[model samples]
Target: MRLNSLYSELQWLPRAPEDFAARLKAAIGSSETDVGRALQRLANYALDLNRLSKLASAIDKAKSGGRSLQPLQPFRLAVLSNSTIDMIVPAMVATAARHGIALEVIQPSYDQVAQEALAPDSRVNSSQPDAVLFALDYRALPLKLSPGDAEAASATVEGGIAYLQTLRDNIKSNTHALCVFQNFVPPAEALFGSLDRAVKGTLRSLIGEINRRLADFVTESGDVLLDVNALAETVGLAEWHDTQLWNLAKFPFAVEFIPLYADHVARTLAAVRGKSRKVLILDLDNTIWGGIIGDDGLEGIQIAQGDPVGEAHLSLQRFALELRQRGVVLAVSSKNDEGIAREPFQKHPEMLLKLDHIAVFQANWEDKATNIRAIAEELSLGLDAMVLVDDNPAERGLVRELLPQVAVPELPDDPSWYARTLAAAGYFEAVTIAQEDLKRAGYYQDNARRASLRSSAGGVEAYLASLEMTITFQPFDATGRSRIVQLINKSNQYNLTTRRYTEPQVIAAETDPEVFTLQVRLADTFGDSGMISAIICRLSQPGEWEIDTWLMSCRVLGRRVEHMVLREILEHARANGIRRLTGTYLPTERNALVKDHYAKLGFVKTGEDDSGASRWELRVEDAWPAAAPMKVVSHGFARPKETLSV
Candidate 1:
């Protein structure tokens, strides 16, 4: 969509009432489950910064008033900026609320980026934020446009990078926070017109160099990059840079773009928290083609290369295919006869997506919400991990009402904007793509076949043996660092501790003598399931080890992967001369599946609080065989010779 239409085309249902602020005020002092639907209904709208600020203010009141906001992840963020960001914090909180995060931003006094990041006792470090956002631009760094001085230009870029890197290193060392860097956005006032990009010493060229180098730095550090430069360019540099506002109060960009900027930042934080959407549920008919396939037979549907309407649908198909290739699970939830839905994929020439691309196909006449839930069940994922894109506003509205957790972005009357709208929504945000990620769609497809195999195998034991699964248990190493961190953050339902660890923290575990870590993988007759589990244990005393982190991807839930993983843990504990193993189940709205996790594995329950969180202890000497069908592949604690990069 055009920059002019950034806030225009989303017609998502259950729009905020005219008295939205009043409703938010009333929502305070109420339980989240009781007020959750109302909160989501209000948050569903494409609200401006002013409205968002009001909503955020109410949420803050509820938090301070001791009302519970369960199911919402709380994130403390330290914002180290060179400009005025006080006006932007509320919008950030509100947008993060839309993504199911209660964001608390810590902003120091104006232009204190250097001192706050460096001083150990600074306000930012005292809060111990999960993330530190370095919101610096060209003016915040040392950049001088010396004409005919290419050597000086190079020094300027290196110096700026060094300055930022020092801040990131200090913050990380002080508080163990992941750094988020914002690349500088060049001003629209180019002195040399198009040559600004070509000249080495020009401000535009300097910024170009900085942005490129910034990406490399972020990749190497395993931190995050907020490409404000790209955001500004997307909105047109003219619209992004407000000269008057900057001169007045040092606003980083135009106030109009604050809402969009906040939304992007929130989604990034959600991705880091493993809350980003995984599945894209698509509606057929005018959505993918010109007419209903049932009415217009396979030959009559208007999906062609030449026609404008057909081309629009084709664009969306291509985009979905690209997403699937990059690890997004694509599902079809159309209200059509299964045979009719299959007809186009089997026979249509211009169709870009085939049946093979879909991980789940629910073409029944059931309500869209029901079918969407069915899709989630079939894939072993949560409703929160899905985004429903439907052309019908009524369907979108109903889905929003019944399933507030699912993301439903409305499509306009025209079909062309469908891809743009969905792309701009940023539902399926990811920070890193692993080898397993590229094959996620294929893994779901394989899961369907495995489910079919289970039904005919007669008994659970027979089914487990027929697959011939192999469990690979290895300590965390360089090769699997990225995927291990991903599992630690994302796998909520099967996660025992529901702990989140940054890449640096994961790396730290590798060399720490007091800690032991494991990365688990499984492969069966069907396919390699990749690294599905990660565990970390810290030495609690002279003879005991406490489970600091334990999580598994839910995709392998019923296959007895956890049994095999526990077996490895017991073996390692025994080899290390450990006397006992302690495990705790910290309860959350999403982790009830694992409340009795330790109990299921034969540990004696020691205690539980009112909230049902429990602790368990297992004597390593009393451990027996885990007895799963999977063949074991033991790496035997092959620790890395050197620290691995993430």
Candidate 2:
């Protein structure tokens, strides 16, 4: 929502308040002494003010609705720098606190001291903090070169890249943390024509190298990279240069820029810290193109490259492609003739996204909700993992009413704003992409292959065994933390006792004396499901147990893996002399598919609650029907440990 606020502010800046303009002008008025510094300060102030106003408006909106805005949880952040940048610490701390994050300054006694401390052998542990901000100033580097020394300038750029590599290695060895590299801001000499043109060129080359290295590091390590240089450029450096006070005061940047920087840092941290939406469900007709294909015909539909309306659609397609490259799955769900709706994607000359680009395609005359349901089923993703994009408010309302878990972004009246609006929403902020993430869409596509194989087999057991299905069961451990937490948050349909837990909470839950946590990973001839399911249960007493949580990845749902997992739980319970197993079904908008699950499992209803949640129990002796041969390889413990410890 903060992202939306910032975007809305940017969209309406041309008509911003007179006071806002006056404040900006006043900031620039003192910036005349040094054009570059003044311009930077002015730009910083404008951006910051925009961020602050948006944040304030969001808070007011929340309060007016009788809902209090919850602050972000406190996260420890380490600022790694030297004395020269100590003054920046207070502003950073203030910004962090505004977002409910706590900043801990980790200043080295000197440059050498800091470098030595961050070395691989040093005591410094990068992962100990959520993130580390490296404020390395290139001006301080010992690069002996004159204005015209092109060779020397090239060497300086190379040295900067090498230093980044060193930093990457050291951080990798020490912590599971994110690294943000800040390029040094050029001094006034380079800006005011005091420095030779050649020297300026060398400095520019060094900055470019830093950007290159940072982008590379991000791609390779999947770490967050904050491009301060890019932010400055976005704020317009030339405009700030006209004001001179920034050069004179040295700290002339407005208070507003500090929070803008903080917002960027927070966004990066969020991306690196949590799971993001996995699927994008797009609507056809006006949503994907300029007009309805059903009425316009293939050629009549406006989707050419040169036309303005067509250009808007092209931008949206480009944005979708970018999301796909970043690992977001794309699916189509529209209410039209399947053949008619897909014509543009298949035959249009300017279309960038083809059928192969999408993981699932559902174009029919069914209601949008039904189409979305089918998409989720076909893709093996939960409804919550999807965000529906449609220009029709009525369709958006229907999905919101029927399936609350799916995020339906509000569409702008102007089609040109569609791409920009989605980018600002930050719906796809994944922290890290695991091996499974990169190939998830392909894995779902393999379902068709599985269906073919099933048709050839005589029966369920024979099909499963012939495919060489192997289910690996392991106790909750550090290696499977992300998958476990993701299951808790995203899984819904097959989930019993739908309780969501964060990573830390999952870890803490494992330490309970009565609790048992298990992860299920299945692999057969087709491919690896890669830790597709999780179950959490607790012993109520001797000979009695309760399933506190149970969820299987939708990908593995129809495989009867859920039945296999329940049987495994029963085996563990029986071995411990548990005579009965209990479970509950709480109704949710998206979980109707599982309403009769307990009954199908032979669970006798013992009672019902006012909220419509049903309580059921199964006798251990007759728990499950005879199940197919499921080979489970167990790890950690065959029985509960004598004592539970953190």
Candidate 3:
């Protein structure tokens, strides 16, 4: 099949890796056009031995020929493993290149993961990786226990885990890089064969117990965990590892599965760097359901029960519902009457997703690309954080062309494959799921209420007054750390400096006398906006403070919250004898919203850094606003001894 038509007609099913690789190489090298899309299609192929081999070969050729492939964003990746991993580097580079991550890997000596991670001078720490991945294996554990020696086996497991934990703690203490912990997979052989299932001292039981502890550590430490055991099971354990390779080359896992493994690691890295998507814009007719909603009508659409086609659509709805439950914002952008489009969701008894589940619904004759832009604007999210799903290839193609930043995954022609396609894309992956996540949909719903209020108010100032909004500032407490870290990491558009911090680092900053950390929560008469902002300030001198980090949730923008926060910061600084405050605005592709932030707050432009980041300074004597625009409440360390009540 022709390359353009192959993708245009959705005929690019998962081919044998070699067949797909050869086709992709030709398609990629033949044209200087749509090279990204061609690679994306190739990446969708199910990973296996042949596929990894062919993919590596294709990537090697592309590199050798200096093909016009899209340039990858550079990322420093440090991999410390007990097993030999030099062979995995090419595959890691290849898979990451496909995903737009130019991975520069740092490999430590075999079995020296802990040593390398703990050494302050080691390359693992010196490279300053975006993240450090520990590729641990069962070989790292001493498993020579005889039957009935359960106590000894348990001790060995405890000691090994303790040593691993110590290494992780050292890394956390020494560096700011995120840690990706890959748990060990149980070796296939059991000392007691099938009886290992019943024996606590068996090799299988010991490994399973170790993994259980590893999972607990991951949760408690707030580190990213790669369940290699789960991946091994998914690919079948026997196929995932090779004993001969382990003995000959110290390659613990099957070489063929390196691509898949790299995919998972790269995904987490992308999410950490704020490249992960948030909103899912879905199409209606033949996309969410088996037929056109406008033509098929509410009762006629095959969305529920009994028939195969109906089941497919039902599964898609259920999948979308699940994503919504996990805090993914769902919106509709279809070419149909808004009323007609919402009828099925309103009237259908069997509909798994109702109208209220959607954060936004824009169903009209307007082109989808424009409507999607509207959705992002309304939701206060960047287009890069959206994933558009549509069954119609034309719609997908148009959106892809118009908004290259938005992830437009190609849906399968068959309805039966819709849910599977979306799941396999892994566009949405969050490190931590908190209560804040579950309540996110409600917060957006409240945004709609606020929008309604804005339209009705007499003017912007009148609207701000009528809302009875209150801004409360609190110290960085444990109760709010998860959401705070999440906001620090995921927040892009409204962030100043755009400095990402992990939970441990944030916690460390909280107790430091030189650092002042505050969490901002806002509430209007409508509802609570949750913890909406965070600020980290460092004492540069006895009387001078520097704004280390300041980020606010996009949902609370345009409410003069920034003014309120700045006002309170000045008040607190004055009270504590801090004479001047210095702040920097680091320009990232996503943080343009805050370019004029310091200037608007009356901060003087001090100078610009080599990287073009602007620096500003505000004197405590700078006149405070004559009157507060909104009520401000301060608590904990952020609270001042005296303040204006309103």
Worst 10 residues of 3 by lDDT: 1-10
Off by over 4 Å in 3: 1-74, 97-101, 146-149, 189-195, 608-612, 626-629, 638-645
Write down the worst ten-residue block by lDDT for model 1.
637-646
Count of clashes, each model: 0, 16, 0
Q: What is the lDDT of residue 431 in candidate 1?
A: 83
Which digits, one per residue and each the tens of the lDDT, describe model 1 over residues 137-186? 67898888865578999998898889988998889879988888888999
Which scores higher on lDDT, 1 or 2?
Answer: 1
User: Sorted by TM-score, highest first, which candidate order results?
Assistant: 1, 3, 2
Write one digit per residue (lDDT tens) for candidate 3, span 329-401. 8888889998998888888887787888888999988888899999999998988788888888888778866
Cα error of candidate 2 at position 606, Å: 19
Score candidate 2 by TM-score against the native: 0.57
Best by lDDT: 1
TM-score of 1: 0.96
Question: What C-alpha lDDT does candidate 3 achieve relative to the native structure?
Answer: 0.77
Please provide TM-scores, in order, for all candidate models, with all chains considered together: 0.96, 0.57, 0.86
Query: What value does the lDDT take at residue 158 in candidate 1?
Result: 94
- What is the clash count of model 3? 0
lDDT of 2 by residue, 433-537 (tens): 566667676667676678778899988768877766777777788778767866776676677776766554677667776887788898878988788889888
